[model samples]
Target chain A: MLINHPLLGPRDAAEFTCFGDASLLLRPDPGPNGEPDQAAMDAFHDYLHLRDNPAGTHQELWYHEQGDRSWLVVTRDTINHSIIKVELARNVKARNLKTREGAG
Target chain B: MRYSVFSILNQALRGNTGWKPVWREPEPRPAYDIIIVGGGGHGLATAYYLSNVYGITNVAVLEKGYLGSGNIGRNTTIIRSNYLLDGNEPFYEMSLKLWEGLEQDFNYNAMVSQRGVLNLYHSDGQRDAYARRGNAMILNGADAELIDQDRVRAMYPFLDFDNGRFPIQGGLLQRRGGSVRHDGVAWGYARGADSRGVDIIQHCEVQGFIMEGGTCVGVETSRGPIRANRVGVAAAGSSSRVMEQAGMRLPIESHVLQAFVSEGLKPIIPGVITYGAGHFYISQSDKGGLVFGGDIDGYNSYAQRGNLPILEHVCEGGMALMPAIGKARMVRSWGGIMDMSMDGSPIIDRTPIDGLYLNAGWCYGGFKATPASGYCFAHLLATGEPHDNAAAYRLDRFRSGAVIDEKGSGAQPNLH
Candidate 1:
């Protein structure tokens, strides 16, 4: 599979390290009291471990170890393994946090 | 019917029409005391043990496809207990013991061959690690031996001894470790469970869980809704997706691991052999075909097929170890979905839902852990407590900093 690294252009999938679902970027926030409660801990645990594991069109984290060392969020169809989109993980995280903040 | 020489003779005399099906094809029942999703080897074995050992006869094993159509029939069939962790060694040892008497207990010829398994080390550090693993195996009541280069060369003289990248240094041998007929194991367990009054339901796809008041009461199947007092999800690759219906997220990811088999040739390999420097392992089947496999595809996927890069990587490892088999024709290749856990170990414990249990996260070792996994999972479902050997396989082990981490790969599911 050819993953288009945001900084390194197109690169082979073997050069990157896979870290599973991109939902990991949306880390759970602290509780209302600014300290972790049971609900917050449970949500944090779920965020860190649980996954969608979809069969198609999955967003995943891939680190370009041999290239620019940038973590890329690669959207690919797992069934056919065709790349859809690639963006820097930091940009995705920032955009998602902003969107959530605006909605909240 | 008992399968003996007398029965064979009687069937021959009667034109071979008196034989019965090994297991009955039953329809889904309205309710059961215990419902086991996924009628693969582990699920069938769980049902068998629950009915026979725990006296829980009102059980149903629901399978989406035919029995043994999953990883139970798609593995490399290597069974060994050569582990270095306290949390894993005893459990695998118990599984190996169960494999020893499995044929007799199930009344089936699973071809439990005890030819042995040898892991070849390529460096001093790998040799030291093997020695540590061997000592742990011995401490766990499993047989292990550390052999020098001379012994390995004497046994298998066809190896590429002159390779510069990976020298032939030594190996770790487990004499009791071997292979079993993978499909026969599933069939035997299904038959055993069927004869013990458990319903073996095929073509029953579980779409979702039937939850009432935060407790899983049953399952919503493609056939219909079926009620159960307790439900155990042993679906190997689909564990995360299956549990998602119950509003539970798992610390697991599905990745594809491929296996290959060459055309039938002369029996060159006597036992299982693994390369220490790489992820390749090979063993000659009874049909004379060389069965081999390597690492996973390194990506989260639910597809039961692999790309060509892993195939090339695996073959390169094979050529590096034994150059003579380079010309062998690879006839078939397939992939099985592995539930890679965060710590490279399994989780067989109660879920947050009151009536639901889990038996998943068997990365690449599910086939080897079939019998004991079933035994322990059955014990847990019956008594509502973890089994002695599986007490460490809790759902919250990662949070509690008690991760088994047999590979010491940390929390990276793909790395594990």
Candidate 2:
């Protein structure tokens, strides 16, 4: 499988190290006072352990270890090794924050 | 028919045509007392124990494919009770004990081999860790021996002991640990359950749960709806998908674990040997092929095949352990989907949903845990209580901060 990096065209998947679900990017917040109450602990536990774990399309984090050293958010099919899209994780995080702010 | 010397002799005298199918291809009934999902080793064993021990013969084991089609037929076939944790040691030791008398108990020739399993340690720190684990095993009533480099060499002289990098210093041996015929386990359990009037239904895919309010009453299958008083899901890799149908989300990720077999050669490795420096375990099959495997492809995937990187990594580990293995041509390789849990341990307990039970999150170790997993799961279904051996395997442990993480790799499925 070749991951089409945003900076580098298409690199071998072996050159990249996968760090599982992109959901790890959205870690849960402890609270305003940073005290881990029951609700905060529950959210953190779910965030750490629970997963969608779908069999179809998945957005996962992949590091270009042997390549340009860029962390890319690769949208790939879990059933077949097909790369749908790849983008910079920083841009994805920024967009996520913007969406959350807009919703708030 | 009872499988014995008399049965073999009688079949031989009758020109070998008197043999019948070991299990029946029965149609699904309208209802059963209990329904077990996934006809893998664990599911079949659960049915076998339910009938033989619990007297719950009105059970049905539903399978998407044929029996033993999952990791039951895909693993490296190594069995051991060399666990370090208090939560996991007793459970696996129970499974190992069941494995010892499994063939005789089920009346089938499973070829259960009791050759020892050795885990080699390279560094002084590693040796100390193995010593601690050995003590833990002994405390848990399982046999363990910490052997030095010379003893390890005496057992297998072909090892790269004096190599510059990752030199073998010592090993932890479990004398009773070994391998079993993987498919024979599934077949024996299926036959045992079938003989006791349990329905073993193949090609019966469970589409969704027949839920009434918040309670699970039955299942909607590919054939039709089959009602049951209680439902136990023993699906290993497909746990998340199967439970999702019941409006439940599990802390599981499906990852592909690959295994390989080399061309048939003379017996060299007497028992299962593991490289502690790297992730590789190997054993010689009865058919002379060297069966071995390493870590799972560290990613969430439903694909039942792994990548070339892990394959190369496994071979490299094998070569590092024993250079002689570099000459053996790998004849076949296959992959199994593993249901990686957050705690790196299994869950065998009642789900929050009424009349629903879960026996999943076996990860890559489901094959070895088959008999005990079945026995405990059947106990739960029959008596509505977690068996003493599997009492700690609660579904709510993650929320309760009681995760039984043997590797101490918290919440990382791939790392486990």
Candidate 3:
């Protein structure tokens, strides 16, 4: 699979280290409760371990280990192994954080 | 009908018309005492044990496709209990013992062969690790033997012993570990369960779970809504999707694992052999085809197919282990979806929803763990308590920091 890295252009999938499901980026925060309550702990556990492993359109994390030291979020259809979108994980994380902050 | 020589002779005399269907193709009942989604080997075995052992006969096993159409029939068919962890060794050893008596118990010719399984080591460190694993297996009342390169050469001299990259040093052998007819396991369990008055419903796709308050009462299937006092889900690859209908996310990812078979050849491989340097494992089937497989496709996917890169990687491991098999033509290849968990172990515990039990996260080891997985899952469903052998397979173990990390890969499902 040719994953078009955000920084390094198109690179073979062999050059990237595959970490499954870009949902992993949405880590649950330790809320303002001084100490984490039971609900926060459960939310954190789900954030860290739970996943939506769909057969079609999935966003996953891939690190360009051999090409460049950048983590890329690639949206691909797992059924036919087709790439749909590619972006820097840092940028995606920042954009998501900004959106959440703006909403808050 | 009892399948004996006399029955065969009687059927032969009567022009073979006395034989009956192995299992009834029943329609889904409106209600059942228990409903088991996914009629694969594990689900069928669970039904069999529930009816026979626990006397819970009012069970229905719903299948989306035909029996054994999932990973149960798609694996390499090797069975071994050579594990290093206290959490896995006893369970798999129980499975191996159950496999030994499976045909007798079910009255079917499932062909459970106990030709030894050997995991070769290429380095001294790897050998040490295998030694530790063998000791653990022995401590768990399972048989394990450590042998040097000479003994391996005596067993199979065709291996690439002199290869500088991964020279064969030693191996750990489990004498009782071997292969079984993969499809026969499902059929045997189905027949056994059917005889015990459990309904085996094929082509019944489960659409969603029926939740009453906080308890799972039944399922919405393609046939219609079927009520049940308890619901057990043994869906292999679609565990995440099926559980999601109940608004429960799983600590599991689905990945594709491919297996291959070569054209028929003379008897070459005497027993199952695993390459230590890489992930390839191979054994000669009864039909003379060399069945083999390697690692999973290094990505999360529910697709039941793999990429060419993993196929080439598996072939490279095969060539590195046995150079003679390089000339063998690959006749067929297929993929099975693996329900990989965070800690490389399984979960056979009650979910947060009352009366909802889960038996998933088998990953690549599901085929070998079939019998014991069914036994423990049935025990849990019958008594509402985790079986002693499967007490470590709690769903909240990840949160409790009590993960049974067999591979020690640290929360990486694909790596496991």
Candidate 2, clashing residue pairs? none
lDDT (C-alpha) at residue B358 in model 3: 97
Over A8-94, each residue of candidate 3 has an lDDT whose tens digit, in order, gives 778888777788889788787786665788888888888888887777899989988888779899999977888999999999999
**Local accuracy of candidate 2 as per-residue lDDT tens digits, B228-288:** 9999999998999999998888988888899999999999999899998889999999999
User: lDDT per residue, candidate 1, B332-398, as tens digits?
Assistant: 9999989888888999999989999999999989998999999999999999999999999998887
Between prediction 1 and prediction 2, the one with superior lDDT is: 2
Pairs of residues at least 3 apart in sequence or in different chains that clash in candidate 3: none
Q: Candidate 3 on B1-416: residue-level lDDT in tens?
A: 87888998998999998788999988888999999999998999999999989999999999999888898888989899998888889899899999999999989998999999999999999999999999999999999999999999999999999899889997999989999999999999999999999999999999998888988999999999999999999998899889989898888888889999999999998899999999999999999999999988888776788888889999999999999888999999999988988888999999999989999999889999999999999999999999999999999898899999888653363453
RMSD to native, candidate 2:
1.4
Model 1 DockQ (Cα-based): 0.61
Error of 3 at B238 (Å): 0.4
CA shift of B231, model 1, Å: 0.6
- Candidate 2 lDDT: 0.91
Q: Rank order by lDDT, top first?
A: 2, 1, 3
TM-score of every candidate relative to the true structure: 0.95, 0.97, 0.97
